[model samples]
Target: MKFNKFSKCLQIGLIAIPSAFAMSLTYAQDAGTRVAVVNSEKVFNESNLAKAMQTRLQNEFTKRQNDLRDSAEKIKTAAEKLDRDSAVMNEAERVRRQRELADQDRELQRKQREFTEDLNQRTFEERAKIAEKANLVLRQIAEQRKLDVIMQEAAFVSPKADITDDVIKALNSQK
Candidate 1:
């Protein structure tokens, strides 16, 4: 019984392999289908549009970042002062100062959180814009080259099939 089952499996595998190979050969021989690959990470990091957007975001957030730095320094100074003077102050005075320091620290943390959230949201928005523009450029290239498929991400792409440089040039040329 085991020998019969093994023979049947071997026959099925032998039939399937040739059928799959023939189908692949037929597909490969077709001249109408053209494929291309694009390095999206390279485009995003090296393109003029992406660089300009990064600069704009940096400028927009620079002031807030500096302010956060200043607030952190102030908090540090207050902490040090409290530590240094706590021994000489009355219990009530020490407690009040500690409470004030805690409040300031919380407020600073809240502000820092808000700043980080805002920066992340803005970065996401900017990335979306860049992706939209890149897609447009990619479609244009695909049409111009008569490509049936243009993959943005691939495990491996040959230099002949990579249209990343062309995409970057097109994006940079646009307003």
Candidate 2:
């Protein structure tokens, strides 16, 4: 009698598990999921925020760039003068002039290196600000449209689901 009861319980367990799995699958298929895609690169390239950042950086660095160019030109002129007059000068004077030229060259290189580092740091900061604003705009769009998911980078995205242009427009509208 115990053996018969054990067999009946085994049979019922097998039937119940398969039925439960099938019902869950059917329910998932019945529910529709909404999805969207955004091309972040396109938004960054086309947005007014990015453009303004570029302009600001150019303006900030222009004077420093021009000054560096002028210093380089002065150094070049001094080097040519030394080359031309070295043969006519006494040994001590020639050595002093050569040392001065080398010092100036080293100082110029140091300044150029600092300029490049400053430019790179500023650019990184501006890009971060743009990304922060873009994320806020993306969240707003997703909430407004009732989107379940918004993918930034994808291998393939249908045009029907692309909201990149909308993102650009929203960014342009903001200050």
Candidate 3:
């Protein structure tokens, strides 16, 4: 009976603490009603910074693609030049051609990987810059409005309100 009472008291305490905290939060919220939210995705997509980053990414991709095409063309040419007359071609010549093709393939693969890494790194840097700038704007807006809480609009389940416009105005003014 003593052990049962102890467990019941522990459970009651856990529930009571959370209930009290909830009531306190309600009271606090009632005292002042300042809140805001931002749509970061919208900011990143619509910002001029995003356009600049896209242009840079396109140039990098295009250059890499052109180089890969040139490599492929050279390999194709070599393949076309291969004499199917096995009887006429020496073993050394055949081995040399095979090695050349293998080397070209390796080079193409390496270039592709490097291009991918560069693109990824560039994207990381661009997003980091944009996110930092947006966050600063968000904080400024929150402070200006005396907001008690600022949240991501996308994260709110019901989305009772949207402060995207206010945030966007702040971001643009920072432009």
Best by lDDT: 1
Off by over 4 Å in 3: 1-9, 28-34, 57-62, 76-95, 153-160
lDDT (Cα, tens digit) per residue for candidate 2, span 16-102:
999999987777557754678998888767899888888999999999999999999999999999999999999999999999989
- Per-residue lDDT of 109 in model 2: 95
Highest TM-score against the true fold, candidate: 1
Computed on alpha carbons, the lDDT of every model, listed in order, comes to 0.93, 0.90, 0.78
lDDT score, candidate 1, position 169: 98
Using lDDT as the yardstick, the better of models 1 and 3 is 1
RMSD of 3: 4.0
> Runs in model 1 with CA error above 4 Å?
1-29
Better of 1 and 2 by TM-score: 1
Clashing pairs in 3: none
Ranking by TM-score: 1, 2, 3
Candidate RMSDs in order: 4.3, 7.8, 4.0
Which digits, one per residue and each the tens of the lDDT, describe model 1 over residues 1-175? 9999999999999999999999987886685678899988898789998899889999999999999999999989989999999999999999999999999999999999999999999999998999999999988999999888899879888998999999999999998
